[model samples]
Target: MKVKELMTKKVLVLKPNNTFEEAAKLFIENGIDGAPVVDKDGKLISIITKTDLMKAILNKWKMNERIETLGPKKVTTINGEMNLEDVLKYKVSRLPIIDKNNKIIGIITQTDLINNLVEKITKKYRDLKNTKLSLMELDSVIECSYDGIYITDGEGNTIKVNNAYERITGLKKEAVLGRNMRELELEGFISQSATLLVLKNGETTTIQQEFNTGVKVLVSSNPIFDKSGKIIMVVTNVRDVTQLYELKEQLQRNKEITRKYVSEIEEMRTQLLNTSEIVAEDHRTIEIIQLANRIAKVDTTILMLGETGAGKDQIAKHIHKVSKRSKKQFIKVNCGAIPTSLIESEFFGYEKGAFTGANKEGKIGLFELASGGTIFLDEVGELPMDMQVKLLRVLQEMEVVRIGGTKSIKIDVRVLAATNRDLEEMIKKKQFREDLYYRLNVVPLYIPPLRERKQDIFPLINFFLTQLNKKYNFNKVFASDALNCLYEYNWPGNVRELKNIVERVVIMSEDDKIKRLDLPKNIIGSNGMVVTLNTFEEGINLKETLDSIEGKLIKKAYDKYGNVRAAAKSLGIDPSTFVRKRQKYINNIDAQYKT
Candidate 1:
């Protein structure tokens, strides 16, 4: 209960300028121990108590003496928002309820607090007496209580229990009626009985009890004394706290998640204070983001095809973040990093002792762990043929059977697979399954390489600079020439490489401004063109040279224009013809770099 609920609102106030004689008369007539002394505007200045009035009379002070002169200049006052129980902790006889403007609104004296407590106790006594008088109607009255009520005889044997008791303890009266509390405790049905405690103490006691049915409850037991002061009955009130415990656990989890979200928001706020928004001026990039937004509502499998460091992973994370399963786990699996020997067990999990050195307890697989959420398979093209077959079955059946375990567990995981490698080409070589390729390509989102979206370079640099500057606690800005040089680079490694280069320059350079000279040697010499002439050869292979030159031109146009169709338009080449040449160029590079 709050102070406002108990405090007397019709209070007589004493002005600071009021005479002590006048204050004494008001206190006598109102029967209030104290009154708050306020200024002309009614703001509390100090309190004038009956004790102060008595002291003034004893000292033989003048009747015309100001009340403010008798009391301390400053007073401790409580706000209306304070809890009554907290206010009672202080030793003050009277407490003034002050408002936000510091004006006295109400007053609570010792008499008010005592009266409230007495009223409650009297009501409870009257109800109990009435209940005892009507023995036939006792059951109906007890059953009306929201809290579970149980009654035990002097011998600590169950006599009566309300409907709420059965629901709370999950124990029916037929099972507990006439049963001894000690016997039930020994049988492990209840952790401990409040009735047994009250019978021994012959007084009121409160105890926490956990039942065998997994219900936790707080039981308050009161012993009823007879004419000889002997315990005649033990009345216990039970309050189930199972849902309370669950709510507490959930609150703890929410607090942890809130902490993480707060940290992220702080970091984002710092970035926002330092830099502009993520740059995506390129039309293709805009279209891709829009498509991703549209596709976030669906639960279809998505295959994100892009070059390494082209923001494919970021796109996948965004999709899952905005999807319905955002609250669930988003597990990322690097298919290429897992060993061929353990791929099956890693994806499908294994039972205990399924293999040597396996965990004693069985482990859940990534798919199972990501149930009702999403599973991102990174570098999925690297999965071996054997594992590919198993993964295909999981995708088709939506279930996984643990190794050495016969039961097939159903899974409801949304698959989001990403790979820089060309799965269609791998399929042609019989390295990737054709069926798996189709299954994962239900919604393909291709992220263009960073080099192709050169407009985004400056913003990305600013973003990285803001992040790195905050990290290293340095003030750094990029020179125009340096930014131009970054724009000129072919960025084979895409945005990831740009971020690394920015960090390297920031850490290595001593100057506040990053100049072109601070850039790496390779970037300085690239001159916005692909390297063509082979140093190892004396004469250029004309066919190889022409193909290399054409590839570079196509890459440059594609970088500037964003897609094959646009690149073809800018180059004055047929869209179909440009695609064919682009494929040939890629095939040549693959052949040259193949292991």
Candidate 2:
């Protein structure tokens, strides 16, 4: 090793003007033997030690002269930049390292050289021990790991290898070593790759490839250099990443196993989302469910357009749970919920004191936190016009400029935007930028309102009842009459409302079996009142009103049963009535009633 390589980069020094009293204190505190002395310009001239000081003190005692004059003659000075051999050949015991600007950077003593020798020998011993351990790996283990461990010469000649290396080359290590890598060359350059790409390019690279032996490996190579800085060897380590990769593949396989699996072990969480309880029988609802599966497969931006409280967040999470980004964070932000004044910071981030009451240590926003993943922006159309400009800049630039920060930080994130507001109307009013809308609407996904998917209602209700059973530790079943009442009412709050209503009925019902009386009072009165009014207003008969009421109740049952078919079965009404009602009044129904 070169002397510079062995030497410490950080050194100690003393100013020439400092008296021995001051220098002695530093030496004692640092536990070093000596310090290099420099002039006002910090130029290295000489080094002083306890021995040198003693020599000066003895000389003064002998000649009765000032010791300052004796200091120059008694000290030995060697150039610090010179190799160790030069100093030893000159018979010097000390070195004074000086910069081009003449600052004294270090002092090297004979004692320091002896200490460095001990350190070098110890390091060499450890390295040799490690090599011995590597050679003895076979004796210590039953089988080798999938990773290929190999060594190559300066000219790229194979020297040593393990079982993994033999497996990767389709040849035994004994048959390959002492041979050039040409003997192990593959037919395809891009396919069966090597860990030596870094060695070939004179830089390190971690890459994935299929080996010639038909195994996939993730490989890394580190270059080894000789004293002259020439490339002498390369040590490559590879791990078989096939099993790990397959697990990832398994997780991303968003297929026909399409039943929603929302966790509801907690109380508040149970009331919030209950997709499985929604029974949907309409063919359009099935189409949307299939579409949800398709959306989960793509990484492109998804724009969700629908009325509020229609299970948009649930759909967004469903998409995330089935996508490639499922393992990463699924950050949610309501553009409308953020104050206009703090919108930029909420989305991009901000520096310390970026504004009044700003976080002191700086905070990473959803965009940064969502990097390497996805962010579901709820009600994206509600973003203020000014923030829209900033968001558009980020989407276009693929970077974010934090509030009060000059530098822009790039991020890799898939955005999912959901909104109840009609973006087209907002665009018409110039409240939302059309350019931004187009950028976000890369893959448009429409989550039909609950009224449209009324078939999904009953299944949802049943699912919620089971969920409530688990929560309150009570068994509760819906009676035919109660189920009928639920089916008849208009759902203004959509699936969210239905789930809460189911949970409320399960918990509040005095009897084990739910009946019409246990149904929410407003729903009971409103369904009958509307039917009575229509019967009188349209000069319709009681039979017509009963048929109409049955249609409405069947649609609600469809929503509760998680589809229309099951609800029709429960109501003893034809399934087509649920389908017709959903298509017939979906647009006019209040969104709040459905949720």
Candidate 3:
């Protein structure tokens, strides 16, 4: 319980300027031994008590002297949010309750706590007296309970055994009622007694017991304490566990079946991704795919941030395919495609006859349609500021009211949004809502551009090539030089541009083999840059010269890209390889300086 619950709300507060006589009069009239002292602005200054006034009298202070003059200025106060038990730790008779602003709001006194505790104990005793009308009724109540009840005296002598106990233990009440628990255990009638354990420990105890009939039961014994803190009786509750053990075995079988199903489902999701043309050869891309798969199991808003054509939509689809809502609809909405005037109605739907050219029947909104499923909002950054507010509310409440409908339709849709714009900058520009941005960016997944994850480009080229081949029923292949040029050219449009280019070359080129000359002029021009070779010196070691040249190119790429992975992609090497080579050059330079 909180301190505020027990604290006296209407507390008599004295002012610091109040004289000792006035303070004494207020205390006597209110029947309070102490009162909080505050300034004119209601801020706590100190506490004045009857003791302080007595001290004032002993010091021969005049009655007109201020009460604050006699008491100590430092006072201990408890926050209203503190627990009631916190009051017990302080030795002070009265504690002032203050809010966060340090202004007195209430007061808790020792008498108030004692009175409250006494009232609770009195109520408990009254309830116990009312329940104990006759021994027959008590026996009936215990017999009606599904669990077995066994009562024993503090000395561990069984006093009573209900019908349920006989049924559970297969022992007659007459056989155990007058028997001692230790004697029963010694005679091998029962394995152990919870009553004996509780009496020995002076506390509640629970254990699994077995009877000579080979029946297992869970037993819990609670000790009843008297006024002097002496244990008077122990009540043991018994539950048959033979069926529970069987049920536990069945549950284990069910868990095994569940594991098999989960493994099969994961395999199916992998196959789904393979068919969906997702190439995850790049370490970065593979990491993103793994993260997406992990987060798909949970229902959380995900924001896919990437450049245009970076396969954000594909990742969103992959997440849906692996999610628990895989069997349900995966609705995709292009926020940028919808017209501004019709955006709200298109997203939220509208009631019949609510607007001009409205559908005759009331339409279900995208959120409602995707209920128990997933919704993909592509180009989410393009949504208007006003629409962002509505979207944020729908996400927050998980419900939406149609454009012209008064009732809110509850939804259980998982939101997956993708954007190619800088939402943080947009928020600063007031083009987007900051709250909406944070709601959508709960789990942000950034897909690296094609240039940054160049290793995946070749696999994606093959994937799209094979797909287009099967679709068009044509046999086409790219020559080694053409492939090299394609790999060398930077794809600003990311995966989408790569797929389009592959399709274009496969369809446009007449030859069976796509040669370097058949490639796009831009691709060739971008890859045609030449390197300048320095004049060869007589003492130049061929390997050392080549190493120096490689080091310079690596350093240049690293400096320009400012990212290890991207720089490695530019150098056509792995990130680990880049790091190793960079360290190697540094070590060589240090060794040269040492020499």
Candidate 4:
């Protein structure tokens, strides 16, 4: 309880110049031991105590015939800031009440001070009893709590601790008490944020930690302050939160176990999200992302066919993430990127002497690393027939035979294949295997080429633009003309090409928003003749249309390669294309129905 809560509202007073006789009589009339002298403004001037009044009256204010200077006239003063200790130190009969302006407002008598002391003493006894009771209750609860408890002095030295603390910290009560908290959390059990706050602000703090046994626990403490606003002690509360935390960890572990048990082989699944990383996006591209999410849930081999910039890898990753294998490994292997000669060795394990400079300690292949997981074979069509045979064996036997090793390791795995090639035609021409085709064609998914997904072009551009902006912290946007230029042009490289273009645009364009003048010189109101293969006037006879398309394609192929052999080879139109054409012309087969 506060002293003010029990203090008297009224007090006695006398003018500073009042005679000793006047002070004595006022003190007597007030039935008090002291009287506060005040000025005309009712502000405190001096205090006349009983003893001082007695001295004054005894001398009769007459010393060598000097009435005003006979007895003690000066009075000792005290401010309200003085606590019980300060009052005791002064040994004064009265305590002065001073305003912040340094003028004494009133005085408190010795009797008033004694009255406050009596009340405080009474309250302290009650508080001590209450604290003892609370401690007993705490002790009772601590015996059974999963967490240990500790009581520390204001300086953060432990004074007491529960048995749980003994078990958790591996420290006895005798060892912990009087020990600083810093020593208790050597393993960083207590958070620095919490520690700093408690030290600086003397506020309560709680933190989570992992003990040596790996059990998680929460430690909390609050400061106890004295009437003088000094912290006297801190009581700490500890509770174990390990059960819940461990449960979550166990569930994740169980998932890994399930993945292993379900698939004895390694499967590489790449389910990439367009928004999954730092990049740009146009509207059509965003739609593709949403579509990819829709396809991810199904476990199937998705064939992503698109130009280089269409983000096929991203699409692949998106599919894997949406499928049940989202939690497993999503490894990526770029067939186009790997060396052709090393492709077989990389996909399937090699014998110790299979090749020069191979690791002496039989190295683990990607297929092995992706055991019970995923291994993305990006640009899969690049595999030569030799590796294709090995891959076929893996699919057929569900096992792997390491190079130089005779043992065949069986495995269960899912396969998701993707390529930018026209595999169907490759199969017809005997370039790609038919068996492999059937195996990989379990669920065929195609990423619509960029141009056809026109809706995604702008949004994809903007997405890339925004990516560049955030990455570089630049508030860059496209100019109206620049945007129109992008929309008007054909994106041959697709999203990848657009991103590079956007990066170039951001660096070259100067205004807050790119303007028409800032647009690349490539497409400025430009109507350069665009010779696309898509244009047509009307429907010709079916055979005529087929012949026309075949002739145009053959011519384009010839012009590009400068001869039939080179054109056929460049167009992958083996003897098959010529042979098929002969048969088609003979049979009068229409080109529109060619596929």
Backbone collision count in every prediction?
0, 59, 0, 38
Q: How much lDDT does candidate 2 score?
A: 0.62
**Model 4 residue 187 CA deviation in Å:** 93
Per-candidate TM-scores read 0.43, 0.43, 0.44, 0.41
Stretches of candidate 4 off by over 4 Å are 1-295, 351-354, 523-595
- Per residue, candidate 1 scores C-alpha lDDT tens digits across 505-543 of 888788999999998776788443334345444564666
Model 3 misplaced stretches (Cα beyond 4 Å): 1-275, 526-595
For each candidate, the alpha-carbon lDDT, in order, equals 0.71, 0.62, 0.72, 0.57
Residue pairs with colliding backbones in model 1 are none
Better of 2 and 3 by TM-score: 3
TM-score of 3: 0.44
Residue lDDT tens for model 2, 91-152: 33433344445444444343333235335433432453255443224323313556677666
Model 1 local distance difference test score:
0.71
- The superposed Cα distance between candidate 1 and the true structure at residue 334, in angstroms, equals 1.0
